[model samples]
Target chain A: MIRIQGLRKFFGRQPVLRGVDLDVATGEIMIVIGRSGGGKSVLLKHMLGLLRPDAGAVVVDGTDITKLRGAALEAVRRRYGVVFQGGALFDSMSVFDNVAFPLREKTALGAGDIAQRVEEKLAQVGLVDMGHKNPAEISGGMRKRVAIARALVTEPEIVFFDEPTTGLDPILVNTIHHLIQDLHRTFRFTAVMVSHEIPEIFEIADRVAMLHEGVIIETGDARGIQNSTNPIVQQFIHGAVEGAHHVA
Target chain B: MTDWSAGRETWPLPARWVEALGEGTLYLVESIGRFGRFLGQAVALVFIPPLKFRRLAGRVYFVGFKSLTIVILTGAFTGMALGLQVFLTLQRVGSEAFVGPAVGIALVRELGPVLTAVFVTGLAGSALTAELGIMRITEQIDAFMVMALNPMRYLVVPAILAGIITFPMLTAIFDVAGIYGGYLVAVMLLGTSPGTYFGQMQAFADMTDVMVGFWKSLCFGGLVPWVCTYKGFHCGHGAEGVSRATTEAVVLSCVLILIFNYFLGSVLP
Candidate 1:
């Protein structure tokens, strides 16, 4: 389980997160939804221990990760797989090398084993033949898939997705969502995803948390969120222009 | 109009100016501190275990071997020009035989290392900055961090070590090429006797002069890539940020090299 309490962050004079509290139970898909630039990504980064909170704690499996540093922090990070919004594949490396990088750096696997594992991951992502191509040569959706393959190659216990379907076309977004669903079903990793795909994302999410003004205003199952009475929640879910959220 | 003194603030402009100056100074100091910290980290990582020979070899090839032609051209042209000027200036005193010594000493003590560093800064330093800047803006550096890889170890140490190892070698090439160019001008074109030219150069240029040049080159090697890589690693986001960082890296490296050259010349025995 991942637990966050009173998380806060500030960028210069601007406060991005203000006492945010959240929890992700084991073996469940928790989708964090918010408006653009509403600190969803920052929240995700805090969970990954990429950014330390100013006043809070992120406890992963009963250990406070914010206090962890160096190898300890790295050890916690190894349990996580993150798919960035832009894929973030190393352009200097071929897709094969990009996927093989984590294994080569972190593990003592032999060359043959690494190659076999890379092949398997590539095949799982439906890019078995495209391994030789550079990341720049592939389309964006394919790059995201490659990123996913690289993330999963380590067999992480938890996976984080940052706007996995933000820039893709509708069909590609659906495809990626389906891919995530299938991967979750197969791997059963505790998934924490930040997205803005709305109703489509709701289809795959076990729980949806609404982040507003640097805090989670509401968190519940899809049906509960859809039927929520809170004006901010109703305004967001129905995409209405008139609500308490408009005052901000 | 009646009470302008009471309405207006007493020290608004001066206060604002002072505030701006303070902010700028703080920013500069913070940047210097960050660079120093990163340098320490890179140096520490260099001596640690898991040295990456393959990456180091590749950087040497790129930073040294590929940079040879430009260094040679710059050194040769500068030497030829200096030879012609020295010969003409000394011709007035009927002591044109001293042209070889003048050219040789200048090349060995100063021009060889300084010119090589300038050329490399423009050529390879800019490339390093741009490459790393792009990597940063594209999130590859963060990806390295997320993968539990120390970019300071994997990316920076090899490049810095390669620079340190290659600069002296490159300066030597530059010096030799420059001396030959001077020889060509003094002996073949200016009608000076080859024995006089060679003998004077051999007599005037000693080990101290050559070693000083090599030392300067070594310092330049360490500093140029250090500044460039630091800028690249800490560059702001997006295309404009990368471009600005590349420019800053080149300008800063060149400036630092020239400044260090002056100080080293004054201090080195």
Candidate 2:
């Protein structure tokens, strides 16, 4: 489980995350929904140890990741995988080489072993035969799939995806949602996703957490979302600006 | 914790001496460590396979190609000026025949490689650092890091390897073009016999002098790009951060190249 305690963050003088706290259980898919500049990404970065809290701690499993330094932090990072907003595939490397990169760099695996593992992961992402393709030559959905494959190649216990479906078409978005659900079910990997596509997220997420005004005001099972009494949750879920979440 | 007390001089002579000595020693040790690691990494990668033929050849073309005309022009002008200045000084002492060898050796041994290295350091060196720095700021370096890769081992080692392996060739090119430029001036403009010029150049300019400069340029090539990229890659704040990193990379590359040149020249046989 990942637990955040009294996490506070700021940019110069303005607070982005104001003493927020939450928990993500092992093997659960949690979707964090919020408006633009609503600190959803900040929360994810903190969890990933890319950003440190000004006042709080992030504990992954039993270790306080915020306090992890050097090798300890790297050890923490190895257990989880991160897919950036823009796929972030190394353009210089082919798709198979990209996925094999981490294995070759980090582990003692031979080239043959690395190649086999990469192929298996690519197959898992349904990117079978496209292993040698360059990222630019592939479609947007395929790049994301490659990114997901690269993320999962190490067989991370937890995968964090930021805006996984942001720029894809609805069909591609639905396809990625299905893939996420399939991966969640097949591997039972803990997944934390930051995205704004509400209904799609509802379809895949085991639970949805709504962050409003620098706080996680609501978190519950997908079925319980429609009946939320919190105005922030209701408005954010339905895309209604009249009740709460000022459009400005 | 940068210490200001160490910079002061009002203390007792022994205390002041100790403080200055300590600071200087630390500086020397740190610089040595940095350069030592640079050499270590370069030496190790010199024999590695998957030699990145396309990328290495591409970088060589860029670093060596785009700077070719500029290096030749700079080299030629400096050569002619050195020849003229040497002529003036030698005429006063009746050792004017030595002019050919002196300027030839000077241009070939030190000036050619060093000047070309500096020019390329400013151009290609800064470009490498800024490109990597931009990647760092955009989280591309983080992307590499998250993949359990070492940016130094993967990205840096290749470029440094390329620079060291290619600088000597570029230096040789620079030396030849520079001497040829001096020949054009010495024979055509100054009326010196081509025979005398060639004779003096052959007899006095030894391999040691020329090779020292070549080695220096090779070292300069590796040092400039490595430090520039290191500074830029470590820049972490934002857009302003990347911009600062780019500028810092360029400035540091030039400064370190010149400074190391001075020290290496002083110590080398």
Candidate 3:
């Protein structure tokens, strides 16, 4: 569903993404695992047309989103929903309003229909009775679930999760991961997630891709990645402090 | 490639000064151009269809109605001060009746619009900058983009429209309160004849003066939101960045209000 080729980005003279090339198949969960701050989110943003690459192309389906502008880019984006690392819920809105926002702004659906849809999404995320509460009033895990509900409310064909479980506790992480897997099974939308939840991500991801420095170093099925001989991948999967990739 | 700036420390002091001046000039010019572009985009999107009336009404409440108490209080105090000062000066010259005209002309022509704008810049403008800056830093804006919503239309156009509509209204309120304040001080306290005071004010302060104030208020209304929204939209990351953006928005708005005030004063009449 998405193809990124020769993606290179730099911050001034400092290179962040250096010639990355990867592909994600439709209706599959593609989880990108990498060291902290290794430009995983940057790659996801390129796919969403949120950030234009310094060089290369992010082609979604057939169109190179990198070159698209204004209405064209916006039309391409209509098929996407993104869950930012911090949930990024509008603080001024209640949970119900946050989920209802996309539908309210984009659709011609009646008020009763919009409310029904928003309530259904809230139920899917297991926050059925928490609609009236503000994001600040909810716990962090609940907030993440609210964000997921908001992202999926539009029933987007493609969804991007940028470290959705970064700060959650281990048990909550498992629950959220399972929640995501169940949703994917039900919705069958193509997903590209950037995560640090190593083993947890491995269990859910159909294909695992490891990013190092700036490029995708390895890409394969979850078992193929586990059994692969790549030293960097092995070291990362095992959580080794000193390995093929430097820590500092 | 030659790196001319690499050894700049070895250059003469005058050369360094010249380079610094050139860099400052370039930065200022670039900022002006960028702000002009932002202003253009804001204006273009403001009247587009599917206008979000709820958002516009919310902003009006914030940018206009919320600032009412401060505007009224400030207006009253300013008029009283002006009246007291003018009355004492005219009393010495046996021209106390002229206090009403002097105070009326000053408030309607200069003080009303200028002070109201500065106050709104500090109150509404800074709040807007902070709100937008936080939204930008938190990736809420990115969410808007991915959802196919135009952030400019969602966030900025309403603010600009609310500003344009409310500034004149608020300025008018300020003028009325100020005139009443002057009446209390000059007529009630100083014992000037009420007829002479109002009669002279009506004759001296014409519709042209009122129009001048109206135009100035309109320009200031647009300027405050333009600068504030731009600053917030492009603010740097984190809490410190949001704070800095808010401060810059207020400061820049006030300065521009004063500058526009002087320019319009000279050009309008």
Candidate 4:
């Protein structure tokens, strides 16, 4: 569903993504794992067309998003749903309003129809009857669920989760992961998630790609990645303190 | 950007200074270009179809109605102060009756719009900037973008439209309140004849003066939101970034209003 070829990005003198090449198949949950600040988010932004790459093309479905601009790019982006790391809920809005925002703004759907869809998504995320509450009034876990419900309300063809379970408690992390897995099974949208929840990610991801120093070091199924011989991948998945993955 | 200081002993001071001057000039030009484009986009979007009436109405309530009290109170006090000072000076020259014309002209042509703009900038403009800055920092803006929504259309157009609609109306109110304030001080507090005060003010303050204030207020209304929204939309990283953007938005907006007022004052009839 997505193809990125020879992608390159630079931040001043420091290079973030140096010719990264990857492809994600349709209806697959591809989780990209990397150490903190290892350009994982940068790579994700490039794919979302939020940041233009210095070189290379990002082909989503069949269109080269890099060449699209303004309304054309926006038209393509309508098919995407993004769950930001912090949930990024509009604080001024109630949870229901937040979820209904996309439908109200983009679709010609009646308010009744929008409400029905929002309520359905909210229930799927286990957030029933929580619509009246504001995002600030909810717990961290509930806020994440609200974000998910908001993203899914539009029934997008693809969903990008930027560390959806980050900053959550262990049990909540598992809950969110399970929720994502369950939703993926039902929606069957192409998923590209940037996360670091090693063992847990292995359970959910159809395929795992390990990023190191601006390149994909390895891409394989959960068992294949676990049994890989790449020292860098081994050190990262094992959380080794000292190994081929240098600290400094 | 080569480090001239690395070879300071060999590099001439004049050359270094020239390079720094060139860089500063380029930076200023770039900043002006960016601001001009942002303003153009914002203004153009305000006229686009599917005008966000709901958002605009909410912003008008926040920017216009909420600011009414401060605008009126400040206008009244400024007029009173001007009236008292002018009356005292004219008393020495046996021309205290002309204090009405002086205060009336000042408020209608200058003070009304200028003070109103500054007050609105301090109140609504700062809040708009901080709100947008927070949205940018928290990735809400990014969320909007990924949802195929135009943040400029949803957020900026309403603010600019609100400013354009509110500033002049508020200035007109300010001028009326200020004129009454002058009457309270000169005709009631002091001993100036009421007929003379009203007559001289009516004769001196024409529609031209009133229009000048109106135009100035209209221009200021657009300027505040233009500068403020740009700052917030392009604001830096976190809480500290939002704080800095808010400060810069207020200071830049107030300064621009004053500067624009001077030019408008000099050129307008």
Candidate 3: residue A82 Cα off by (Å): 1.0
* Rank ordering of all candidates by lDDT, starting from the highest: 4, 3, 1, 2
Tens-digit lDDT track for model 1 on B1-269? 12223433565998768866887999999988999999999998888889889889988998999999998888888888888999999999999999988998899889988889889988988899888988887778878878878888878888899899999999999988887888889889999999999899889888999889989999999998899899999898899998999999989998898899999999987
Better of 1 and 3 by lDDT: 3
Model 3, residue pairs in steric clash: none
I-RMSD for candidate 2: 5.1
TM-scores, chain B, all models: 0.94, 0.78, 0.93, 0.93
Q: What is the TM-score of chain B in candidate 3?
A: 0.93
- Off-target runs (Cα >4 Å) in candidate 2 are A108-113, B1-98, B105-110, B161-169, B188-190, B198-219, B235-244, B259-269
TM-score list, all predictions: 0.95, 0.79, 0.95, 0.95
Least accurate 10 contiguous residues by lDDT in model 3 chain B: B1-10
A86 Cα displacement, candidate 4 (Å): 1.0
Model with the higher DockQ, candidate 1 or 3: 3
Model 2's chain A TM-score stands at 0.97
Query: TM-score of model 3 relative to the true fold?
Result: 0.95
Tens digits of per-residue lDDT for model 2, B29-62: 9976875775575556657653556667777776
